[model samples]
Target: MNSFLSNAKRSCGEFLSSFKISQSTILHMVLGNNSCDLDSCVSAIVLAWFRSQMKNGNEVYVPVVNIERKQFRTRTEIAYLLDHLNIDSRNIICIDEANVRELSNVGKGFFHLTLVDHHVLLKSIEYLQTYVKEIIDHRPQLIELPSRIKCNISLVGSCSTLVAEEMLKNKAFSVPSVVETLLLATILIDTSNLSVDVGKSTPRDEAVVKQLSGKRTKDELNLLFRSVADAKFSVSGLTTEEIILKDPKWIENSLETIMMSTLHLDVREFFAREDSIDVIRNYCATHNLLAWVALAPVINQFKPIALYCEDDEVREKIIEKLIVSDLLLVKTSDEDHARSDVKFLRMYNCKNTRKQVLPLINEVLQQRSSNLSA
Candidate 1:
């Protein structure tokens, strides 16, 4: 176990335990995005540690995982990496119902926030937007933050890359190898082992891996990537519902709501599972979603963009727009010709991700609504 992570674990526990609403010192909270993936959690944990070690950095920093602590197990890769470092996930500060209320009640000017891995403030934490002191993310700036807040937004494969740069810039640049390995592993997994074919890796991401990987050979790095990715994509014990909820991204428009989740297993195998269809329908109903989009990654193309919706007209319109648009959708060979209830399409434009698809889907939905009004 690296000494820094050990210290971080202890420090996070101590701070949370000692935190009080009446405490004189403001709680400097470092938080990641709601998804709480490996990159998000690592960035939060490491960036908080880095800031706390600076001169005049006596104000304690607490790394807060933005999800409920119970959901920590659902973040398999995060759990695996922390456990490997001998850092118990239980020791981490996670957002719970009680914690949310407690922090929300931390009177104005009594709390400070640093956002990582995400820029836009969601409704859950919008109350703390004015209290935000720093913004660090690798995505396009989506929200207008206060002028006084220090912004470090840039385009990179992983937000971890930006956090790694911060760690490197510190004068007292003594970071533990376990911490380095954690950052490197996150960048590798997010960038697909920094493969040129995947095209997600930027120069900064590559540099982080090259520098932090140390004497570990190419094979060692590859093994590390597989270990983390295996944990990330592993669904051995998870039920179908758990798999769908693992990394869900919600898309809501005035006309409808759609739930999109990454399918770690093969799409065909997923569809064949018992009660899978019922689960999708129930999930949609429970969340008031009009549809569900299940995406599975392929080596060269995004194969099998699956859609589950009972509304034939709505699903077909979205499909038609995608087929003619930049996504370059084509029907799958394994498409069930008899199954009119589901639609499976392939996308030739492998570079575009959900970030790009979400807007396009929204546009399609908007147009359909306009045409109906017309």
Candidate 2:
């Protein structure tokens, strides 16, 4: 009855007629990072958009992380839309921890398969590429791939926002109030509330959030902020080594001595609990280190405040000064600020920092060698 819903119906009819996909065709809805709000929002938008375009008896499959992981929250949104349209639930397939190899083999006979994701896991992308007729992502790598795989990359704030914008353009699904709220939450979480240090907010995300939560209360913003802050670091059952390797960039540099530098206490708990700094120092003391850097990215007024230290003493001295300078500071007995320091090295993609720091570390190694010779 509303303009948005009417437009959604019209768009779905047009797309179904255009694609010529029959009611018997199976539609696979693959999602990544079920724990992430952005992923959940994107999955809902894509499923709703597709449902609008199809008729009865078509199948929709959703791949979840685990049955108990609560990835199926998107199902509620999907149900809302489907119920409005009088669609049946029997046609939807919700698979959890699915074996990709097995699913591909099973879907081989199906006429149409579509995959949507924002996560940049290479292995998952390759697997989906094998059978997925269409793929949507914001990762630059997906855009670089060959043309046969239908890939759309907009580099927006959140992949869910991107999909919603696309649907809005095509007049596909009704942009429901809840869908809009989810999109706004995803953008805020992903962009660190549009802090410049994390990178500027994507225009698309900004526009959608503005359109959805017009004149949001301060309490609402605070609640959203808390939700994201709580999810930023997960340390349960994780070793110091495991935490370091969580980022893919760090995994690639596992063989080399990577320099991690952070403002002293940010990762003090992690380094101390895992005993990683000692491990790193011992390893660097023995092996040939290819890279090393200490980068302290201080958040001052929502911008990156960088302080570079090439030597351990220099870093310690600076941190002491910082503590004395009225900045709320905590010192670590573990002395593994280097681990958090190096973690950011991979995060900001600063290869040049490694080039600068390694030489200084090597100098320290050589100075110790000269002292031993004396």
Give one digit per residue, the lDDT tens place, for model 1 in 1-374. Answer: 34444554555445445555236555678888887888888998888877777637346677887887666778888888888777766667776632545655666465678899887665556777777899999876645777999999988999999999988876568878878988988999889899887688899999988878878899989988999999999887888888887776665444566777888887878878877888988888987778888777763455568888777888887777677774455555446431455677787677666665666676766676688678
Q: Which residues of candidate 2, in runs, are more than 4 Å off?
A: 1-25, 33-57, 61-96, 107-113, 118-121, 124-127, 170-173, 196-198, 234-265, 275-374
Candidate 1 C-alpha error for residue 236, in Å: 0.5
lDDT of 2 at 289: 41
TM per candidate: 0.86, 0.52
Off by over 4 Å in 1: 1-22, 55-58, 253-257, 299-302, 310-317, 327-334, 337-339, 362-374
lDDT of 2 at 235: 36
The local distance difference test score of model 2 is 0.44
User: Tens-digit lDDT track for model 2 on 301-374?
Assistant: 22112233345664554345433432222332223244444322222232222223333344444444566567
